[model samples]
Target chain A: MSRSVTANLKTKYLVMTKKVIFIILALYTFSSWSYAGGGWPVPKGGFYFKLSEWWLISDRHYTDAGQIDPNITSGIFNTSIYTEYGLTNRLGLVVYFPFLSRAYVNNVVSGTTGDLLIAGDAINTIGDTDIGLKYSLTPQGSIKTAVTLTLGLPLGNSSGGSQQNLQTGDGEFNQMLSFDAGTSFSTKRVTFYTNVMMGVNNRTNDFSDEFRYGLEFGAGFLDRKIWIVGRLTGVESFKNGATAAQVNSTSIFANNSEYTSYGAELSYYLTSKIGFNVGYASAFRGELIFANPSYTVGVFLDFTK
Target chain B: MNIFSRAILWAIVWSFLSCIGDDIIDDRVDPVLRITNAIDTMEINTNYTFEALFLNHVGKEEVITLEWNTSDPDLMRIDPDGNATALAVGVVRIGVKGIAPSGEAVQDEVPCVIGNSTVNNLKERKAIVKTTSSYLLEGDAVLQEMEGGFLKLSLAENYKASTALPGLYVYLTNNPNTTAGAYEIGAVSVFSGAHDYELPSEVKLTDYDYLLYYCKPFNVKVGDGKFED
Candidate 1:
C-alpha cells in the first residue's frame, strides 16, 4: 500500500511538471520571433513577422592575434524585416531582408591646426539578404530537432565612399546548413528552454568558409507575459581565403573574420499577437572583427496564437 | 497610433540618426632645428655656407632666423648668417639655435675638424622599424641619397609585416604621431623580405625624420622608424 502511494505521488508530480512545460512551450512559440525557428516549426498556415533595426558603431577592432587595436570610428546601421511562414506542419520558409542599410566613417581632423585631414563619407543601399527553408525532424518527441538550409545573397554596396573603404556587405554569395536541437523543462513557477545549433557556411568569391555554433537559453516569467533570452553565437574561419596583401584592396572588410558574441534580449508582450523586444550583444573574443557592441530594437507579430 | 505605423516611424528615426561626425587626433611633436647641410671636415682657409631647417611644434616647416655658434672661436668663426670659416687646424662643434612660434627654443650641433678637404656628411641613414600597435611590424629601413638627387628607401631582407592589414602604406614625415604633413610614398605591396621604394628627385634626404607605416583607408598608424645615424 505504501509503494502504491509513492508511485501515485510521482505520477502526479510528473503531470504537474508537464503542464508547466506545455504552458512554456505555448508562450515561446510566439516569443522566438527575433531568432526565429529554433527547434520548432510553426503550425500550418501560421506566420511570424518582425520589423527591426540593428546597428554597430566601432572605433576599434580585433587583430589577427585576437588583440584590440584602434581604428577609425565607423558605423553601420540596418533596417530589416524578418519573417517565417509555415508551408506545412513540419516545413517552414524564412526570410531576412534589410531593405535599407547605411555605413559611415568619421571625419579626421588635425588636433594642432584644426584642419580637416580626411573628409567623412557615407553610403546608403540595400543590405545582404537571407532566404532559408527549415524542416522539423522530430514532430512529437520530448527534444525537438530541426535542419535548415539558408542562402545568403549579396545585395548591398560592397565598396563605396570616396576611398572605397565603406561597405554594407561582404560582397559574397554563401550557403549555410544548420542543425538545431532543443529541450524544455520547468521549475515550480518558472519555465525554461535551451537550444544548441551548429552549422557550416560555404562562401564564394575568394572569401573563406566558416563553422558556426550557438547556444541559447530562455525563461518565461510573470505568468508567461514576459520572456528573457540569452545566447552565445560563434564563428570560426577556415582561413583558406586570399590575404589582404593578395587582394590588394584598401577595404577593411577583408576575408577570414571570426567572433564569439554573447547577447541578451528582453521581450514584452502587450497582447498575445503583438510584442516588443530590445537586445544588446558584444564580442568577448574576436579576430579581424569589430571590438564593440551591437544593438537591436524591434516589434513582432505572431499569428500562431 | 497603430503598432505598424509606430514601427515605421521608428525605422525612419533610426535611419536619420546616423550622421557624419568628427574625430580629433593629437598630432603634436617637439620642435626641432636641423642642420640640413653639415660637413664632416672643413678645409683650412675655406668658407662654407650652412643651411638650417626649423620645424614647429606640429612638425611643420617654418621660416625662422637661426643664430650660429662655434664651440671654440680659435678654431672656427661663424657669422649670424651661418657662414663659417676655419681659422686653425683643430676640431670644433658647429651649433645652431632657433625660437619657434610657440616660444620653444630648439637647437642642433655637429662636430667638424679642419682637414685637407671638406667632406659632406654621411649620405645614408639607417633606422630600426618597430610596431607601435598590436600588429606585427618590424624591419630595418635604410634611407640613402641616390644619383640625380633622388632618395631611395630600402627595406632589408629581415623585414616582415602583417599581411592582414589593409591599405598599408609607407610615408616620410617629420612628425611620428600623424600623417598630416607627411609625404606618402605608396602602398606597400611587399609583406616580407627586401624591397626598394624610389622617391622623386625633389624629396631631399633630410626632409623627414621618421618613416611611418600607416593604413591609408583606416587612417591609423601601425609602426614608425626614426632616421638614426
Candidate 2:
C-alpha cells in the first residue's frame, strides 16, 4: 500500500506540471494577439513607409568666440518618404527619399540681402538620401534593442544658388551610426512604450561633432486603435573648426549653438496598416533658428507578412 | 518524474516574471515635462507679462509655482508674478523656475536686451513746390531755398552735424558706439515739380542722428531786367 501511495504522489506532480505548461502557452498566445491589435513598432517580417514633413530651425554657428549674429532663423520644409523591408526576423533594409526640400530665410539684417545673403523663394529639390540596415540585437518578450548604420549620399542639389549657405544639401557625404532600443507593455485597455536612441555623425568638414538624443512615450485608447505620442529631442555640438566667412557676413555672433525641442504627436490607425499623424514642434532657445513654432503632418503605411 | 517536471515548470515561470520586471523598471521614468506659455526673453526698461501651464504624467493640468530671477541685479529685475522691469542697457539672463506638485523642478533661461531710451526728438518734415510753363518763361524760380532746405533733422544734446548742406545729403559719421547704429533713410519726389514734397510723419531722435536733405534750386523771376523777389 505504501508503494501505491508513492506512485500516486508522482502522478499528481506530473499532472500539476502539465497544467502549468498549458497555462503559460495560453498566456503567450493571448498576449501575441493583443500586441497585433495594438499599433506599435513593426514586428519581424514587416514593412512600413512613412512620409513626413520635418521643419527645422537651424541654430548652427560658425565660430568659437561667438562673434557673429546668433539669431538667424530659417525654415526648412522637408518631405521625406522611407521604406523598411524586413530581410529576416532580426534584420531589415531601409531606403529614404527626401524628394522635396525647400528652405527660406526672412528678416535678415542689412548688407546681407539678395545675392549677398541667402534669400528668395523656396528651393524644392531632392536632398541627401539615406540608405541603411537595421538589425535587432536583443529581442526579449517585452523589450527590443536594434542597431542601425546609415550612409548619407550627396546626390541632391547642393550647389544651386549663389548663397553657399542656402544649398539644398549639406554638400559632404556622411555616415551615421545609431542604436535604437525600446520596450512595450499593456493591459486590458492601456498600453505603454518607451525608446532611446543615439547617433554618431562622421563627415569630411570639421563641422563639430553632433549629439542627438530623444525620448518617446505613447498611449492607446478606443480598442487600441487611436494613440497619442509625445517626444523630446535635444541636439548639442562642440565647436571644433574655424568660423566660416559666409555665415558670419549674414549674422552677428557665431558659435556652436545647442538646440532642444519638445513636441507631441497624435496618430489614428484607419486600419492596421494605414494611419495619419500631425504634430507641432518648437525650439526653446536657438540663436540662428526660427523664433516661431514649426508644424508637421504626415501619413504612414505598415504591413506584416 | 515528479521532481524534474516540477523544477522545469518553476524555472519557466520565474523567467517570465523577470522579463516583466525588467520592462516595468525601464519605463518608470517620465518621458516628457510640459510647460506652456513660458516667457523666454524680454527687452530691458520695458514691462512684460509672463505665464505658464504645467502638464502631469497623464496629460492632466497641474498647479505649479513659478519663480523668477535674473543673472544681473543692476541690469533687470523680475517678480514672482511674472513682472519684468529693465534697469540698464545690456543683456540680462532671465530665468523661470517651475516647481511641480511632486517636487520636480524645471528651469529655462533667455537673454533680454535693455535699451538706453526711445527716440523722441527726430522729426519728419514735408515741403511742397509748384511750377508752370509761364513761370519758366518768365524766369521765375519754382521754390524758395531755405537755410536747410527740405532736410530731415534730429537734434539731440551733445549731437551736432559736422557740416551743414542745403540740398539732399547724408552724414558720413556713425554714432552710438555702445550698440545702437543708424539703420536706414529713404527719400523720393512723389509729386514732381507741380506738387508738394511730403516726408515721413514721425521720427525718433534716439534712433537716428543723421539728416537726409532733398533741396531744389530757388527759381526767382527776372522780368524786363528787374528782379522780382
Candidate 3:
C-alpha cells in the first residue's frame, strides 16, 4: 500500500455521519493491539512473527457514572507473542499467546504509627491466549478487506492472587468476529493510509459481551522507509455482567472491563526484513478497568516479504 | 530516527513526567475529630469538659488547639478551655474543633441536657467489647442515647486493634457472621487509644446485639463484641 489512492472509493455505497460515528465508538473499546499491517494479508506460505510488551499502572478508575475516582493502585505487565501463517492467498491462521502476565498493587501505610494499614499482594501467571482464522476478500479497486474469527482460551491464572480482584484472567471462554477495511493513497514523498475494524464479542462467563472497534491513520514517507500511525480504539459492554456488589466478593473477576483509548505507533525499518514497532495507549474514559495509559514495544520478523 | 519515533518518544517521556499522581492515592481515612467522653445528658449547673479522645490524619497533636463552642450560648456556655456550664433549662450542643499544623480541621458535637428528667430520654452505659475472633479488639465502648437526638459510640482509653488489617468497618449488627442486617457505622477511622462515632437517631441499639469490626472489601469478619450493660 505504498501508493496514494482515494480512500473514499466506497462513498457512493456508504455514508459517514456524526450519529453513525458516535454509535460505532460508543459500542466498542480497545483491548488488544497486535499484528498491525498496511491493508495487506500475509502472503501465501508466508510466516510473520511478532513479540511485544505492554505495561499498565492505575491508581484510579472511572465509576459507573463515568466519573473518575480513586481506587486500588493496580499494576499489570504483559509480554505477548503473535504468529500468522498464510495457508492460501486468501486464507491465514493466527495465534496469540501472552506468556508472562503479572499483577500487583500498592500498600496503604499508616501515617500515625509508620505501619502498614493495608496489605498488598503480587501475582504472576500466563494470560489468556487466542487463536483465529483470517480470510481475505478479493480486492475491489483499491479497497482491501478481511474477516477474522477468533477464540479466546482461558489458559491464564484467574484465581492465583490473594484477593479476588487481583486475578490475571477472567476464567471464561470467549468468541470474537471482526471485519477490517483499509485504503491507501500516495503523494510525491509520502503515502497515506487508513484502516478500521469492527467486531463483536461473546463470553461464556457472566462477564458481559461487547462491541469492539478500531480506527488507524498513518503515512509512509521517503519511499516507504518510515510509517507513522495514530490509532483510536473502543469497547462497550452489554451491561449484563455481574457487578462486584452483586457477586460474593470472593468470586468477582474482570466481568465488564471496558475502555475508550487512543494512541500513537511508530515503525522504523532498520532493514527490509526487520523493523521496530513501539506504541503507547491510554484509556481516557472507561468502566471496570484501569483508567491509565499502557506502553508497548515490539520487534517483528517478516521473512516472506 | 523516523519523525514518528521521535514524536512517540517525546509523548512517552511527557506522559511519565506528568504521571506524578502515580504514587499519590487517596486511600487514607479523612481527618476526623472523635470525642469519647460525650454524654447524652448533663444535670443543670453541672460542669462538663469537652475533649477529643482520638484525632485522625494528624501526625503531631501537641501543636493543634482544641477549641469548644456551643449551639445555644444562652442555654450553655463553653469556656476557652472547653468547659461547659449549663445555663437555662433548655437543650444545647457542645462543639469541639481542632486544627492541625497541616491546616486540616476535624470537628464534632454532642448534646448536653439542661432540663428536667421528664423530657430527657438520655441514657449512658459502659459495655466491654471483647474480640470474638483472633484479631485484637479490646476496649470499653460508651453507648449513649442523647435526650435531644442521636446516639454516641466511643472506645475506651485502653483500646487497640491489629494494625495489619485493611478496610475495617464498624457496624451495629445482629448477626456477626454476616453484615446482612446491620447499621453501618462507617469505616473504622481509629485503631488505638480512644475514638468516638456519632450515629443517627434512626438506628436503635436495642435492634442489634453485637458490635462488629469487619473488613468490607475482603468480606471477612475480623471480630465482634456483644453489647452488655
How much DockQ does model 1 earn? Answer: 0.62
Model 2: DockQ score: 0.01
Which rank order by DockQ, best down to worst?
1, 3, 2
lDDT of 1 by residue, A141-227 (tens): 778778888787888777889888888777888898888777777666666777787888898987788887877677767655577
Q: Candidate 2 chain A, which ten residues in sequence have the lowest lDDT sum?
A: A21-30
What are the per-residue Cα lDDT tens digits for candidate 1 across B1-229?
Answer: 9897889788868776889899988888889999988889999999998889999888989999889999998999999999999989989999999888899888999999998899886798899999998888999999999868889999999999888888889999999888878999999999999999999988888889999999887777899999984
- Winner by TM-score: 1
What's the residue-level lDDT of B45 in candidate 3? 70
Off by more than 4 A, model 2: A1-45, A56-74, A106-119, A245-257, B1-229
Which candidate number maximizes lDDT? 1
Candidate 3 chain B, run of 10 with poorest lDDT = B18-27
Ten contiguous residues with the weakest lDDT in model 1 chain B: B8-17
When sorted by TM-score, best at the front, the candidate numbers are: 1, 3, 2
Q: What is the TM-score of chain B alone in each candidate?
A: 0.92, 0.34, 0.46
The candidates, ranked best first by lDDT, are 1, 3, 2
iRMSD, model 3, in Å: 10.9
* Candidate closer to the true structure by DockQ (higher is better), 1 or 2: 1
